[model samples]
Target: MSVKFRPLADRVLVEPIKAETKTASGIIIPDTAKEKPQEGTVVAVGPGKKDEPTTVQVGDKVLYGKYSGSELKLDGKDYLIVKESDLLGILG
Candidate 1:
């Protein structure tokens, strides 16, 4: 996917991965009870601060703090703009 937005100064644009809607036992979870996903796919990345370069890259699956990042909508899709520091780690 091509995103028109680009983050600047060590920030990242993430497309949140939706939390599971069903349990292993086949129980359906309600929206009100679902927790925000702490994981997402990196959709866009910014140039690093003067000295440091951003590490994450687009298409990288990553883990982040549950409360990290600011939420926004693009093309009716939800996204998060977080600092590289807010990212916990890149998933293998």
Candidate 2:
């Protein structure tokens, strides 16, 4: 991923994964009831603050809290900017 926007000082830019929109039975879920995704791929990461380096890196798929990070849009795609602490863990 080549994002022009780079995060600074412990901030990370993440591309959020979309939540499931259908059930196992093939039921289509309406937009109004869709849950915000809690998983995403780390697109960019900033240099860590003094004495603490960032643990995650670009292309790392991570899980986070449901209400973590600030949301923003870049080139028509949604992204989140969160501190390294906000990320729960990296996915396999």
Residue 91, model 2: Cα distance from true site in angstroms? 0.9
Error of 2 at 28 (Å): 0.3
Q: Give the Å shift of residue 15 in candidate 2.
A: 0.5
Top candidate (lDDT): 1
Error of 2 at 58 (Å): 0.4
lDDT of 2 by residue, 10-75 (tens): 989999999899989999999999999999999999999999989898999999999999999998
lDDT of each: 0.95, 0.93
TM-score for every candidate vs. truth?
Answer: 0.97, 0.96
* Model 1: ten consecutive residues of lowest lDDT: 48-57
